[model samples]
Target: MIVLDYPYVSRFLTDSVLELGQAVLDTPQARRLAGDAPLHYIDEIEFSARLALGGKVYTNSENGLGHVLRCRCNEDLARQIDICKDKALFRESVAALHPDYRFRRVPFEDLAGLDAPDVDYPFIIKPTRGFFSLGVHVVNTPADWPAAVRAIEAERAALNAEYPEAVVSGGEFIIEQSIDGEEYAIDVYFDAEGNPVITNILHHTFLSADDVSDRLYYTSARIIETWLLPFTDYLRDVARECGFRDFVSHIEVRVTETGDIIPIEANPLRLAGWCVADITALAWGFNPYECYFKELRPDWDAILTENQGMATAMVIGDLPSSLDRTRIRDVDYEGFQSLFANILELRKIDYHQYPVFAFAFVSLPETELPALKQTVSQDFTRFVVTE
Candidate 1:
């Protein structure tokens, strides 16, 4: 029941868990138990060894020390680490055990084999272990492949030079056959028994036109679904195959021209960034943060049984100019806050720290798509960040 919190997303998770009435251990105490806390109240080795030997489950042990501890407690933690570390291996193992389940791995170099004559242009390339869209590229044509490869190589080289210890050795990037369909994301939570109990779906829209190339983009709107019959079966099969019994998964899927469902990629972790939490609250009327904390909460039957008229949009603010910086300080925060009061649910004001990244969520009674576009364009100018 101990929870370690960090950043807004972690705070949201911790708060949600607490709201569910779960007794969570504080970070300091948890660290102390794990033998990393600065306090001298406990013997580090004895405490951690006892905790592991006593069958206390530790979460988020992906760090260096965590890896070492897991290795030491191999008898208890080996299955979890092996299942979590290598997804392709897990898929293969599952497919072997369950012949009915279909699993395929198209290597980074084998994408051209899947290409059909009608398989349109603009495919995406990505690394198997990539996150947050890093090492992702879109190839518009066969001619673009070499240049894209060169760019990726250059970036990798730079990263290696700067932080050689941080770079993974001998990593390969996968070139996926792009599915030219609308993008949607599903956030699924599995129980200890490996059942996909709670699921949420969101429609993701890319901010930059270039970002839509082949992979790596954010969603503009989300629709959470509690009872998803069609998708739940496939998701459960995947979860069981992967040996992921208790964790959140982010699944990317696309609807093809023929209305077939094609799964693009899956992340065996929480949704990156803030949109998942935001959309869950706005669209589902439940905070995922809160739900995640509730121990053995009843599985949702069918909350978002169908897609509602509600829509979500993200505004990617442009970089401010020197002139705008001079005037940004003069703007009235209270006035601008009131001006855009009706349309805004979340406003991230510090764009400079992150650089050219700000997002807003809007919910309207009617789907005034054109009016929504205009509102964002006009309102963005009001909060110019001046230096």
Candidate 2:
């Protein structure tokens, strides 16, 4: 039995093992939709999650206490790091493992002024409990500090109106010295015994240093080819150090040129947003969601032995524009495909909470990245949206 949170389920991914006769989906929405035979009903979200995920299950939480408590059928340990959800708290965990880690917290209202006078430049300031990169600022210099603060404040104001319940509204954000090197996003599931089973390791291609928007943010599974061993080892050590077991984490880290591992943060929740989480399926033959439910550990040696070609996932939206929610009303499907190729799967939908023209791209290396990125730019440019 798998517990599915109604709110987290996506519309594009449906018809999965859970939706089929493979596994039972337990959720409030599923129960409600079942009507007279509530036990037999399934949630619409499970399908969208499947369509995007290519049939993976959404299970596990980093620190989802409410979710763990809601249904007795769910995993209770998912909330092992409830306090760790806050960036400051998680930083403590990371710092404990690595003494070189550095971070501090400042009130959201003081972000512009940054009450800490000695705080150096070229740092990152983000909500203690933030998601989707909202209110995230990278201050490169003293001059950039004011603008960063203003940008964060403006974003906080907008979020106050739109996402009032966000943890950012709680008043504090964390600051940390920016680590130098390649940034990678790792999606993994820990078995009951605390062994981490990695689903995917993505190499992040950002638009710019200060671009907080997820738009133009691209991650390719191709990275798994070179640095998988080192990253997997790092995450395993992090999980053990943080005392995480029976959970899933989507952690971001910086791999220095010399191979030093620095964790940015681990949002110990499921991986990715929308169907982006499912990109693991394209990277590997199995679905990441299924890994959690089935408690499957990736047999890297065997899987890699059989797999051919590489998969890349790219996110294109109104990035490099504004953090303000961009409402998309129209999408040029044909036009979008015309620009890019090797498109394994693409799902364009209105992410109500984020409110932007967001789509997940699972592409094969049949086409070069430069050509693919050019098409992605055109798709985002022409995609109709209320910016």
Candidate 3:
């Protein structure tokens, strides 16, 4: 069973759900978004009953988590969500895995009272329950704390009404020591026996050290080939540690200089939020959603042979923060797409309803990686025409 809710659902996901004959939980939002799409609707009662019978449930967005938590009959599943959603709790849960890791959880009201003099430099501070990169900031020095606090305050006020507490809570924040190395995001599920099944692996790239925006993510056969086996092993350990079974997660991790894999956080019961997982389909010719429902794994050797040296990317077209969205008249999507050599799909979002303008998927060769890097650094304000 799949539960669909805001902020965005890709056409690829909706079609895949229908193609796999998965029942979408009947909700007004689902109905409205999937108009005339012939989706199999399952009422709350039946869905809850299926949950009691250990039926697997996958949610596309964390916004759908509230509904799933209310309807779910499995306490274990709820527990898993609790651990993954709360960044502080997630850190504590996995602390045994990395005993040397340092972290502290602070209440939202107590943020101002935090003593910067005693604090360690080069740490990350973010809402305990956060989605995307909202409220995430890196404090590299004592001087950065005041600015970070101010940013968090602004974010607290701006985001409180924008998302559900289940999605982005402002009640508490976590301060953790930064992990060094290359970051990657994975879409994987723990099967009935608790074995990890990795469906997609994306290298989360950033232009600079302080750039925490979710502007770009891409995947290629080379990325999968290098990290698949090690990540699978690490996730296996994580699943066992967390007591996870028949659960899906979008996990972020940093592979250290010494080749140690340290988890950042695990987003439970979904692939990458906002259908970024579709890059798997665009790159490897398989549906990520269907892979979980049907228990299918791609033959990596064969897939790599077919998709050598190709990179598929998901670029977020975020509106410039300084631009007044309320006064926006038009978005130059054509000019934006002109930046890319080959766009596989462009999913334009309603900027009036959401902060982003679109989610673009592009296909690139390994030699063209510089283009992806260059695209992320582009100023999005140039694409907006405000009244």
Give the whole-model CA lDDT for all candidates, comma-separated: 0.47, 0.59, 0.88
By summed lDDT, the worst window of 10 consecutive residues in model 2 runs over 56-65
Return the TM-score for each candidate structure: 0.63, 0.79, 0.98
What are the RMSD figures for all models against the true structure?
7.3, 5.9, 1.2
Superposed model 2: Cα runs more than 4 Å off: 1-8, 11-13, 17-65, 69-79, 112-117, 160-170, 216-222, 319-329, 351-353, 374-379, 385-387
TM-score for candidate 3, please give it.
0.98
Question: Candidates 2 and 3: which is better by TM-score?
Answer: 3
lDDT of 2 by residue, 1-387 (tens): 333333334432344433434433555544442333423334445533442333333343222234333332323343443544677877776676678666787887676555433556678888887766766778787776777776776676665443334323548888888777878878877766667777887777665565455554344434666767887778778777777776677888888888898887776556765446766666666766666767777787777665545546665554333433445445556666555555666665444444544465656563466655555544354544444
Candidate 3 per-residue lDDT over residues 78-107, each given as its tens digit: 999999999888888888899888889899
State in Å the error of residue 163, model 3.
1.6
lDDT of the structure predicted as candidate 1:
0.47
Better of 1 and 2 by TM-score: 2
Deviating ranges (above 4 Å) for candidate 3: 117-119
Cα lDDT tens digits, model 1, 141-256, are 87776777666666554333211221221155544456666677776667677787553566655535455422122222233342256567767777666666656556666766
Q: How far is candidate 2 from the true structure (C-alpha RMSD, Å)?
A: 5.9
Tell me which of candidates 2 and 3 scores higher on lDDT.
3
